[model samples]
Target: MTFSIPNLLSLFRLATAPLLALVFLVPENQNIANIAATALFLLAASTDFWDGFIARRINQSTSLGALLDLLADKLLIVTALLLLLDAERAPVGACIFIVGRELLMSALREWVAQNGKSSTVRVIAVGKWKTGLQMTAVPFLFYAGDLWALNTLAVGVWLLWAAAALSVWSMLSYCLALWRNE
Candidate 1:
């Protein structure tokens, strides 16, 4: 349970999750809140990459750190998605699929861990792609505005659907791999 730098970064991301919702509390300053939430989400998402990279690079990858990192990623992502859903920036169908897949995967991982088969359900390429797409889409959704000639909300919705598709693919892939290993 040593507090490594990477673990601290994860904690920072976890702490930032609730802050995103707080920004939306000020409906009078919608534009400013949107910008602030987007910035916070981007910063938190960047830490997800950095924490893992630093952990591996520095040879400080501990079980606790891994747990912290996973928790942080889930919390931040779910919070952002929920916020986007509430703001009507993300589609209901996409949110349901994404969040449902996440919960299912989390439970499956726990079952595998309890059975001492955790290696059977390791994170796969599709899962990484899903995370990447989600991370990219979330900030856009949070901003929910136009950037010069680009409509970010449209792009975000497209990317969110893609991420949701990837989530289902990744979940099925993991399940198949686990079943085969079992």
Candidate 2:
């Protein structure tokens, strides 16, 4: 339970997740909520990278920090997805598929761990790309802006689909690795 700087960053991200949700969920702040949520989401997502980098650089990595980081990411993305779904900015089917995949993957990972094969479910490059696309899409969707006649919502939707595809692909790869190790 070391309280390192990187862990602090993870905590900050965790703290912002509900804030981001509240901004979009509150009816009174409807007009300015999107922008504020976008800002908060981007800020929190950026810390995801920094926290990991800092932890490794300073030899401060801990199981708790990793758990906090993952929890923060899940919380933030889930909040955003729910908000988008409620606003009809994102398709409910896609959101459901993504969320379902996440749950399935989490359970799969736990199963792998319980079987003493945790190392088999290593993070893949596709997963990193999926996360990058997801992080990029969420803020654009939150902003919901138009730039040079380009509709951010449309672009975000495209990105979300790409991210989701990669997510499923990565999950399959992980599962296959675990299966192969068995």
The candidate that wins on lDDT is 1
**Per-residue lDDT over 99-157 for candidate 2, one digit per residue giving the tens place of the 0 to 100 score:** 87788888987888798887897767988887888899998889787868889899999
Model 1 stretches with alpha carbons more than 4 Å out:
none
Query: Which residue pairs show backbone clashes in model 2?
Result: none
> Cα lDDT of model 1 overall?
0.91
Predicted candidate 1 versus true structure: per-residue lDDT over 1-182, tens digit per residue:
68888999999999998888898656578899989898888998999999999999999999899889889989998999888888889999998999999899999989999999989888788999999999999999988899999999999999999999999999999999999998
TM-scores for the candidates: 0.97, 0.95
Q: In model 2, how large is the Cα lDDT of residue 3?
A: 81
What C-alpha lDDT values do all the predictions have? Answer: 0.91, 0.85
Q: Give one clash count per candidate, in the order shown.
A: 0, 0
- Return the TM-score for candidate 1, rounded to 2 decimals: 0.97
Judging by TM-score against the true structure, name the best candidate: 1
Model 2, residue 129: distance off in Å is 0.8
